[model samples]
Target: MSDATLAIEPSGPKPKPIFSRRNIIVYGSLIVICLYYLVPLYVMVVTSLKGMPEIRLGNIFSPPLEITFQPWVKAWAEACTGLNCDGLSRGFWNSVRILIPSVIVSIIIASVNGYALANWRFKGANIFFTILIFGSFIPYQVMLYPIVIILREIGLYGSLTGLVIVHTIFGMPILTLLFRNYFTSVPEELFKAARIDGAGFWGIYFRIMLPMSLPIFVVAMILQVTGIWNDFLFGVVYTKPDTYPMTVQLNNIVNSVQGVKEYNVNMAATIITGLVPLTVYFISGKLFVRGIAAGAVKG
Candidate 1:
């Protein structure tokens, strides 16, 4: 072949640059969406760092030109809510209490129920499971009175125990769904072999399934921690003032009408109240993806 003919022409077209027109558009759109989500948090931090005077004068989106931690201190210890000016600490601890018991009990109940539903398969079990799943779709507003009556009859209507039970009951459906999906994804041969080896229900769960399901369990813990920590309506409705969760008390602090609204303190309290769930999310983020994938390949 002639030298000119042997020379290669470039392929069909030039490759688009990573930062080319399409990519810039795509990435620019994503960046805008991210900024949209982050703006509130940035505003929260900025407001928390500013004084009431600065807050009133400057825009919420402005960074604090004069950063002060008084808001944080007040939010944690000095801010008032009606007769109790002890600040958000009490509510924070109360939430911790509510969070721990609620998570443990909810997880235990959900796991047992999930194990039964996935493996046991009794005649009416599916019917009950269907009802329970449907119950999850019901608005809390609709069931609020029935739940209140039930708690009242049990003498737990306004107690922490009652509140914990309320968390457990409401939390059951999702957690059960999570565990059931995870468990169902497990190999049937393992379960059958365990049964053949004379492992009972509890035995199989503890010995065979538990170790293999830690990712899903972490995911469940993440869900429960976030839900129970951030819960306001249930905490307010199910418990009395003394047992109020952080969310309820935070609302009380910000809007209790006993004093002029301190925007800085309100913002600080909001950040403090949000920290637990945020912490859980940051810590368990990597495992969260795995947890969500628990049953997908199997199903």
Candidate 2:
């Protein structure tokens, strides 16, 4: 009986479920962080959906007692910013126009520069890249006047074309570094195979690299789209009043001292201004995460 009792039964308790203490802590932390980030967004939405009387009566953090979309309609169509009663639509369209070109041009230049830096290894490329990267750290304020002067001399000042070029220029350093490091992480075998198949520089990039580096591209797109879309400094510095990008126009509408403040309309305009970038970020969520992870792996 003693010997039989000595044979220990094999009963390992069932493996822990997916919702252990560690899981709870992690999930709880994530939810708190998410709420922290989203609180302002919620406030903006709530405020926008509310009328002026409600905004005056209630805290901004409070949800609207009665939701009305008139604020949105007014913001999009009738809200006046000085003599311009056309609302945010003008700025919205201007931004769309600016955004498309800026994103495309900036991404193209950055990707090419990064690819070249990573793979070409020409004489003094690193030295130039070093200078370029270091240039990024210098405050944009320091270069603003010079850029203005240069743009004026080149006859691109205060124009959308000039703004696009400005975006492309400033965007180069980071994008180049990103693409460079990402390409550096790529297995050199595919490159060699492409070369063996008689692919030239452009051919290799277009045929092999471009197709494979999609996540990195998406990362770059996210970076450029958000950055250029939200940029106020360059847009203000480089564009005429009429050509002002959405961010710049948004600020003008909210802060302009022409009439009594309309909090609801201002908030509505802000939400609309933010929607494009938000959409891009949300839609690119998975790819953005993958891109960031992939980028860090190399550089």
Candidate 3:
């Protein structure tokens, strides 16, 4: 036999180079996009650290020559948002009050709705789900006045409770959709076994579904928290100044026409306002990705 006939060839295709054209294009685009977002954030951080004199030097990209945390302190405690000399502290607490109840109530209700829709067949389930799908796409502008009147009639207008209700309602369509899709992806055998064990609705949910639904729940929590925390139009229209949310207060602080604009304080307050959602995303980022992938696969 010839020498070539005795040798074995590799079974699979050869590996591509690490720096292939496709890799270069994808990675280069990603790097550029990262810089696009990260540069502004870098400027905001550096500007927040520098004093007014250094800021006026017109070098926004430059790191602070003399770093000071006074801007953060002022933004937290002393910056005048309006008639009130107090800074973001009031708005921060108000946002928390608004955030917690909104997240809890919305998640609970939406998860239940999703589970029922996915697992429990009913006469009008299709119709109800269709309505919810439409509701998700309805422009908030169209519903604004109607919601205001509804809140006013219920004596919840201009209150945190009213705002909470608004958040919960608006959050419903999307969250319910997310949970429903995720629950639908769950193994039918497990659900059937739970039923065979004489498990009721609540029993199955609490014992079987809830234990496996952590990723979706985290996804829901992060979405609700971000939406409720960053809401401005609702916060402005539904509540008075005393109960204004952090976003509203941030707007007031940034737009105040009363004095020289403190760029440092504005930047500091902006970062502080964004911290919660950013923190939540970073902490549960993996879960969020997993939940999205799981929920999207089946639905």
Candidate 4:
């Protein structure tokens, strides 16, 4: 009688193996991709630490037996870029000057455009957005000459101010699209409530949209910083030798034909040039992911 009263247990799904075929394939691909990128980075770091003799004799993959920061110091302070013997210091400052205003002005204008398009519902909004989206797809190479002329007409050519304006304009379309998509994801109720509570455009933007928009802003910042910082085309074309940005200076340093190739110095300079964007991404990586996911959901 007691045995007959016993309940039957339910069998749950079997645990998947850690080394299952799917897991192995996915993890293997990831490992390969990571190594593909990390190996070069490893080589760069190691080579940057090695002296010229060690770098010449040793395999690039090998660790530095005698670590020295001479290459890094040279790359940062003493490397020649065309007629200028001053390393990347001037270019670095130029880049900073270009980056700050470009990022700020672009983000502010784009965010406002996005907010208006998403919530304000003005006439011709769709047409305006379509044109902007269209602009994003237009190759920068195609517009380079046009921009040069425009800058020249306004007398901004070869100036850091001109570069800043170029970056701001180029960045606007994509950044506006990102911000618009993100703002569109915000609940209509919140926007309406803010409006009823006497919040105007700027008020809602400052009080409501912005606080909840840290992720997207981080995403925008990362995108703009990376693009502007690494841009060689614009930096080279729009500015003269003296106003060259870090990327342009880096190109000159790496490609200079006047002396023996300083491989260690070149590698160090490359890494140094890349560090700003890398640091920015690493710090705000989580927010970037969150923003991307949020944007993906609805737009």
Which numbered prediction scores highest in lDDT against the true structure?
A: 3
Give me the displacement of residue 263 in model 4, in angstroms.
0.3
The lDDT of each candidate is 0.88, 0.87, 0.94, 0.93
TM-score of each: 0.92, 0.89, 0.93, 0.93
Model 4 lDDT tens row, 211-293:
98988998999999999999999999999999999999999999988879999999999999999999998999999999898
Tens digit per residue, CA lDDT, model 2, 1-299: 55577556546885678999999999999999999999988888899999899888869888889999999998888876556778889888888888889888888888888888888889999799999889889999999999999999999998888998888888888888899999988877777888889999999999888987889999999998889889999988888877888888889889988767888889899999989989999999999889888844431
Q: Where is the poorest 10-residue window by lDDT in model 4?
A: 1-10
- Tell me how far candidate 3 lies from the true structure as C-alpha RMSD in angstroms: 3.2
Ranking by lDDT: 3, 4, 1, 2
Cα lDDT tens digits, model 1, 1-299, are 35566456557986567878889999999999999999999999999999889998969877898999999999999887767788999899999988899999999889988888888888898898898899789898998889999999988898888888889989999899888878888878788989999999999999988878888889999999998998889998988878888999999988877667899999999999999999889999988988887665441
Q: List the residue pairs that clash in candidate 1.
A: none
Per-residue error at 209 for model 1, in Å? Answer: 0.3
Error of 4 at 228 (Å): 0.5
Candidates 2 and 3, the one with greater lDDT? 3
Error of 3 at 46 (Å): 0.1
Across residues 63-92, which tens digit of lDDT does each residue of candidate 3 receive? 999999999999999999667878999999
